[model samples]
Target: MTTLTGTERKNITPGLSVSIVLKKDQRSGKLTDGVVKDILTKAPNHTHGIKVRLQTGEIGRVKVIKTGIV
Candidate 1:
């Protein structure tokens, strides 16, 4: 097992809203905010961020955890 460092995935729980960077939008550094519909990451940790599916059916890695109103 290896521990990931530098830009590692953030802690995300189901039902929590978060901003993610999809594969298609990673180049533009864009962020899509939505409620966490499902957590695709099963391992304890990851390097490239946690993978999850948003309520809107978009899949991406969690970049920021959206807490307050946007």
Candidate 2:
């Protein structure tokens, strides 16, 4: 399966499945998976990743955009 990076804001949308790294988890590179609830990044893209809020209310910078499923 092919995976997409989450550095661009346009590549992400609400209700999409994604993996994100919370602020506290950045050092550990831990990924939190969830459906996107909101797009928090204002720019077209971010060098790190686009910030988002998951359905579960967790906010983080997107790391992976899981495709082929919603």
Candidate 3:
């Protein structure tokens, strides 16, 4: 179970479980876990993190990619 840093777009995909930092929670550096529903970031990589929309409709930049889980 190798986890990815979640800063690269190539590491993220639909259905993958990930921890994200929502815009509102950015100040607190909080993490919200959910399954990825869509890849929102167009770039290959980002300084902050790759933004994505979770299955539950929450949107944020990825902080950690939870490998081996869906």
Candidate 4:
């Protein structure tokens, strides 16, 4: 008999470091709030507020609370 193990999966913590995209307004260029579910790809150093997945299943980019930026 051969022994088998379950497949390994990626772990997503509650407070994991992630990036979100900022929604743009017609007039203002301010960033918006969003959720961070899965990172599409690594963000550049200059990049901020990338796309993210929300707990409500809505995926979009948002300004995430980080060390420097509040």
RMSD of each: 6.9, 1.9, 2.2, 13.7
Error of 4 at 69 (Å): 13
Name model 3 segments beyond 4 Å from true: none
RMSD of 2: 1.9
TM-score of each: 0.76, 0.94, 0.92, 0.35
Q: lDDT tens digits, residues 1-70, model 4? A: 2211111112222344433433445145454444345544344322333345555555544444433332
lDDT string for model 1 (1-70, tens) is 2222213434577888677889899899798878888888877666677888999999998877755543
| Candidate 1: stretches off by over 4 Å | 1-10, 68-70
> Per-residue CA lDDT of candidate 2, range 1-70, in tens?
4579999998998999999999999999999999999999999999999999999999999999999853
Computed on alpha carbons, the lDDT of every model, listed in order, comes to 0.74, 0.95, 0.94, 0.38
Compare candidates 1 and 4 on TM-score and give the better one. 1
After the best TM-score superposition of candidate 3, give how far the Cα of residue 60 lies from its true spot, in angstroms.
0.2
Better of 1 and 3 by TM-score: 3
Candidate 4: misplaced stretches above 4 Å? 1-35, 45-48, 66-70
